[model samples]
Target chain A: MGNSFFTPLSWNDTGFILTGVLNTVTISLVAIIVGTLLGLAVGFIRAEANRFTNILLGGVLDALRSVPLIIQLILFSTYVGAIGHPLDPFVTGSIVLSLYSMAFMSEVFRGGFESVHHSMATAARSLGMSYWQTVAYIRLPIGLRAVFPSWLGVALSVIKDSALVSVIGYMELLRTSEQLISRTQQPLEILIGVGLFYFIVSYPLSLYGRYIERKMAI
Target chain B: MEYEFHWIIVFQKLPQLLNGAFVTLHVSVLSMLIGITIAVLLAIMKMSKARIVSLPATLWVEIARNTPALFQIYMAYFGLGAFGIHLSPYAAVLSALVFVNAGYLTETFRGGFQAIPKTQYSASKSLGMNSVQIYRYIILPQMFRRIYHPMTNQFVWSILMSSLGILVGMDELSGETQRLQSLSFRTLEFFIVAAVMYFLITKLVLFSAALIARRVFRGDL
Candidate 1:
């Protein structure tokens, strides 16, 4: 049996783990940024005045949301490889994660956009602002703030769900910990350590989510 | 481009796939039932005024909620074996699902609990109802009503999340589909079928939950 309380973490090993952490964070951040933009566009498309456009965007979002992320990852990887693009696991995983996050984030932004008072948009238009300017100057800022809490929820979920990429050999934090545990045969220590790493990443976001909620409430 | 599609393989594997779907459904339903029980207890503990009780419950919820269900499953399956506690693959998946679901459900229930006005509890006390009576007759019913939609959403999520059980060799729907795909080498077909099955199951579960909610909260509707 291994030591229970104090299995030492070597600095060399910690460096490797930190690299995995960096990879995970980089993938998540890129996914979040791209996903949020795509989601905003889709959300606006769904909320567009044209009925056919609204249905098309709504259908796309529903299809994305209904499928499991792991399956989506595998499908994307296989299709990309078949097309000869042959992305590395990181790139493929980021694309999949971004697409997945876009579905949920679109819902969040849709709720946000809907919460913008109709009168405000009208007032902006009455002041001779173009349609684009009304949305950019008046609707988007307030709408995003209104949905900030929900966006935070989606962001936290994306961070946690990004762990699924390890299944496809992404070599992120979870995969690194799995490799370490297998080599060291210290499953508990490694699992707990990985859990702690996850906590460090997620707890701050959760606290910030609460802070946003409080600020919005005020 | 004369790629012949094989409906025969899908037909031949239907029985195995159905059996796997049954296992998936069984595990999800059982875990959800157990998880909700644990969640209710944890929610109550979280609401407790005592630091000792709330502290541990808070920690458990935070750890479970923040970590991926896949990791939790690995810990239950692989980590426990290091401590000489070995669970079957299905057992490990079930227990992990319960643990993870409990964390989310506790939050959902607590939200419901908080939504209840303090005056309602005070009024129950004023009517000379004991704590048990108040909880059973007053708080629980209303809490259930408020949490119904979220709980339904959670159930759908759990069903989809159960796909992870395939990683640990539980021959759930995803696992069976994966095997079929390997044999037939029809990746898109198998995945598209599996995705449709998942969508169907989720829609069925959501429809039933909506029906139940309508029955329970007809006046509110």
Candidate 2:
């Protein structure tokens, strides 16, 4: 077992593990882009609409927020499969990840938009700017800046969560590590490598998030 | 052609699902109790003036927060087996969760600690109280009160994150659901019910926390 630990895994095995990293990044990027767009729309609607509409939307988002993402991923995929139109693991996993992210992202954006003072919008309107012009020129920029740190936090979380797609047989980093462990019988080294990979992916984003928060605080 | 949903299969299995929910709650609550105690110490250490006292705490929180909980669980359950220090699935999941909970709540707790004015500590010290007395009488109550809402939020997070235990072969709620669904082949119905159960559990936590907060902090800001 001692020598087995020291035995180097072949370049082929290392390449296979790195493939999982690619899938992880792809899934996270697609989810964040799609989720952010959808979330922005929902946040805008929730922030700008009347009280009744706000309450209606809030309830739906809250439901999505309350349910754990693991359940959502499993339910959505299995439901699709049961209906006789089986989704590719990547497709279904992406769909659920985006939907899960959308809930938190919309909440972040809504809070950001609300942080913009009402007087700013009122003054813009008094200056004869249309609602859309005010939103485009003034509100959105301020809100996005305000929400950047929180948005980064959510994005980091997405990368971490992408690991869960492994449960659905999507073959991300954690699943790849499991495969490597079985083949090599070196779970300790393999899993430590797995943790290092995640830390590499997430720590910079976390540092950047802290940097943004500090920068914005001024 | 219409597809029929046989939710009856799920209903018939309600007892087992409820047991799974109980397991979920048990793990989450136990981990929180153990984790929060360690978190308090870590929080204090983070606030220490000496790097010797603080750096290790900082490192633990950074690693735990940045990485996925799944990785921790895998490392505990499968990784440690290589070193011949094997743990049961439940023990592995629980320990990993405790590690995570402490990491997150350490920050929350430190923030709570920092939010207090230094004058309070000086005031208590000037009253001839010892450091232990100062913390017990002055710091802890305020820290707990100030951070109560965030603590509740973390509690809910712990509850949800505990679902990762399923991957390690722990028969928690998600694991039970997977087991039952595989047997019944009523995948959709079982998962839908499981989702509802999870939703209700989290909502129940929120609702009860609010109730307790109202009672505990009555007439206080």
Q: Which candidate number maximizes DockQ? A: 2
Docking class of 1: medium
Tens digits of per-residue lDDT, candidate 1, B106-138, equal 999899999999999899999999999999999
Give the per-residue lDDT of model 2 (tens digit) for B1-221: 24589888899999999999999999999999999999989988998999999999999999999999999998888888877889987899899999999999999998898889999989998899999999998998888898898888888988898888778778888889889989989888887888888889999999999988889878584
| Worst lDDT 10-window in candidate 1 chain A | A1-10
User: Compared to the true structure, candidate 1 yields what TM-score?
Assistant: 0.92
lDDT of each: 0.85, 0.89
Kindly report the root-mean-square deviation of model 2 from the true structure over all alpha carbons.
2.4
TM-score of every candidate: 0.92, 0.95
Chain A TM per candidate, in order of listing: 0.91, 0.93
Report the C-alpha lDDT of model 2 over A176-197, residue by residue, as the tens digit: 8888877777788888888998
**Model 2 spans with C-alpha error above 4 angstroms:** A1-8, B123-137, B219-221
Superposed model 1: Cα runs more than 4 Å off: A1-11, A83-85, B1-5, B124-137
The weakest ten consecutive residues by lDDT in model 1 chain B span B1-10
